[model samples]
Target: MKRFVQARAAAFRGAIGAALLPLVLGGCATTGINKGQINVISTADEVKMGQEMSAEVAKQYTIYNNAAVTAYVQGVGNKIVQHCDRQDIEYHFAVINKNEVNAFAIPGGYIYVYTELMRDADDEAELAAVIAHEVGHVAARHSTERMTAMYGYQFVASLVLGQNPNACAKLVTDMAATGGFLKYSRKDEHEADELGAKYLYAAGYDPRGMVDLLNKLKGLETTEPTKFDTWFMTHPATSERLARVETEIAGFAKLTSPVRNAAAYAKIKAQLPK
Candidate 1:
């Protein structure tokens, strides 16, 4: 009887392995933004990481509180998100009270823009371009990919798989200190710019807005170095980015009469603390 039971258990184990073979093979196949990339981090973990990092950022900076301005930013962000490819994830947008002319996106969909960046935008389209660029970063899973590359995939996987909140928080915070979350490689930036323009065009916003913002930042790189420093200090806008964005804009020529929404942007700009 014991020998019969042992044989049955062995057969069961083999059957289980056979059943799981297809699943294992499917998991190995690449899809979406993770295609051709070595991303071991799962989607749920990416959202958790963004939530933790976003909370940390909120603790460090004051969230801007102007009702109308906040609403306007959210409106623009929402529109771009609707046209984005990664609709499976929820997106969060906020304006920080800092005067820095910069914006960043964490894994998942946490995107933040500084007040001065919004205030400095030439129009609603420019602001949308900035938000869309960050969205592109999130949509592309750049941060998760970056972390996977920086820290080995196994190391990142362990924190997420451990299912410990504190461990996940600590891992994200440590990455923040290393400037891992703050900067993207120039290749990443180019990808973001191109993707941002594609989103802008899809959302009926002129893709030229991206080109305009890049030009504005490049021109500011010399004249008002200090003010521009707020943005360039962490995220450097290079000549290559400008050229790349311009080329991207050119591709959208067939997109007819994209909305610039200048007057509405002026009204939102007026609400900012002067």
Candidate 2:
């Protein structure tokens, strides 16, 4: 099984490299985001790619079925999205039924949080912190940027165009099995932390929620390392990230009142599987 998976991953990588060779050699046209980063995939194509990839994700993992729990997550995610940098695409949020403590965003605006992460959060603000960070990745176009840098723009555009279904499926499959093969860099992780704090503050959630969530993860890293393996695979060091989040929160102007919404979140938590 391991050899078969490795073979599929290698084949997918080779296929993408071959398909994108021309665009890489000739240099492709790029689009700009708020962060001034260039992306080879346009917004429309990004959304299409996300829709396609999300379908594959749905096949790989079971989405949490409780409407109330899912709706609560969407509500928090929407609140953060309102204050995000990109508004071109509609954001979709869902909870995965998996027990692993992780959250991830795909090419477009689709963000997913795991049930274990939700159950672990102390309040709504902490949950919002994770969602905002994922939203930050979306706003900054980190996924497509990383994809463009790794696979080349033409290869990703081909996925958007449905030019190679087998390669696309293999790519998503490898990502799922490996806890996200399309991992972001340390720079990308820091930028997302900064942006998440900004959104958390602007959305009327206490900016400290970001700090608290990072600290919680840091503790989990020390105590229950296995639960955080997938999260740490995608996200870099929690201690460093927590320090940066604290610095970001320190810069925020004091608001009259900030929201944590612990009570509401507790109700939502009760609805999760025990």
Candidate 3:
């Protein structure tokens, strides 16, 4: 009898997998399909969650703003956005009124840059590297991957905690803190670098933006790790990654068609709050 029950359970699991196959396959018809099996969450769901969390964070912290700085950031972001295929999503770029040299992205195209990052950046191209990297996170749907993974874990967490459905979800979201562990696998990091590099090149920013940014961050780490923020926590900048980024940029011959916007960057820096 036990053997029969086990066989039935196996059969049921197989059936469910088969049924889910169509939903997964047909999901490509929807927007934001990049690679297979990595179903992009709906824009509505992404925006709702991102906006909620973003609002909470913004309320918790303050936003730094100056017309010049704000305009420069938006301009850099817009240059990269033009190269992206996902235009349906709303993208906003702003500097957070914080001392940390970091940048992060939310699911529905919400991105934040710390004033510290802007202040430390040598040129607009360096800022482009930061923007492109954050955009890669949104484009690849890393946020959704995190939420989906957490949901699967919550299913088991619910059974163990013996909580009501609503309570379980809240507990799971808080405990998992997807933003913290949104740290991707190694392959994902490499892919993001490639994507960032490509965007920088296409956006008319020198590919060296990536290399320069990585090197600058490396120097900062030598002085102190606590000085940097979201970039290090979310994305690693190892010596190896720096070497590869340099090599990658060396291959871009036409990138010199236009140079970094140094004057615009300096003008924006003057407007930042003390």
Candidate 4:
């Protein structure tokens, strides 16, 4: 009887320890990607915080106002989302009614497709390429990875590194407020390119959309986005990353089918914000 009572006490202690974990640890390292360059911080914390902050951003921008346009974005988005390895994520995608010629994703499968990108795509694969890249961010666990990196000094907070919880909270709050959820390092950029290309092929979209999207960003780098802060900082479409993506697709098994859905792409273009 005494042994069983002791075991019950031990079990209770274990439960208490588990509950206290997040408070002390702050939830870092969510994805399976190695501790290399990608954001691999605690995914649950980042996703929860991202959902909180996303609510604020969503309120400011009206979602894309057209049903057919929304449907098209959702359809392409759903196809790519399914092929992703992160089965736990639902990937809630929406079209933001902004004319910034950009798209981005948040942790926990929240993806945003701007009207500008929709209007900009000349083919359906172009859109798929973008979705795959965003999905790449999710799959790579870049959100949590970036958060771990973005906090930059959470290790300092831990007893393992430096033990500074207050500093850790400050760093996280700064990231949350500034939208530093996940921005890939150059290595992360290349890795996502590779994984995104793989997924692009898997989802039945030609990998060229990766190249096309990069090319478009290269051209657009000459211009400034309408609200230029978060997206630009993270997605640096460099010449080298772009070039490597081309090499990857070229090396893949040849895709005999046409990649672009030109007619569908154009019909939706008319509805986007100019």
Most lDDT-accurate candidate? 2
The C-alpha TM-scores of every prediction are 0.80, 0.89, 0.77, 0.71
Instruction: List where candidate 4 sits over 4 angstroms from the true fold.
Output: 1-47, 152-182, 223-232
Q: All models: lDDT?
A: 0.72, 0.82, 0.67, 0.65
**Model 4: lDDT of residue 133:** 80
lDDT of 3 by residue, 125-240 (tens): 99999898778777776656554443442332233344443533452344223233255556667766777787888888888878888888889877877765444545555687
Q: What is the descending TM-score order?
A: 2, 1, 3, 4
lDDT of 1 by residue, 207-233 (tens): 888878877877766776766553553
- In candidate 3, which residue ranges exceed 4 Å CA deviation? 1-30, 151-181, 229-231
lDDT of 2 by residue, 167-226 (tens): 678767767765653667789889888888999999999988888888887888888888
Candidate 1: what lDDT? 0.72
- Which portions of model 2 show Cα errors greater than 4 Å? 1-35
Question: How many clashing pairs per prediction, in order?
Answer: 0, 0, 0, 14
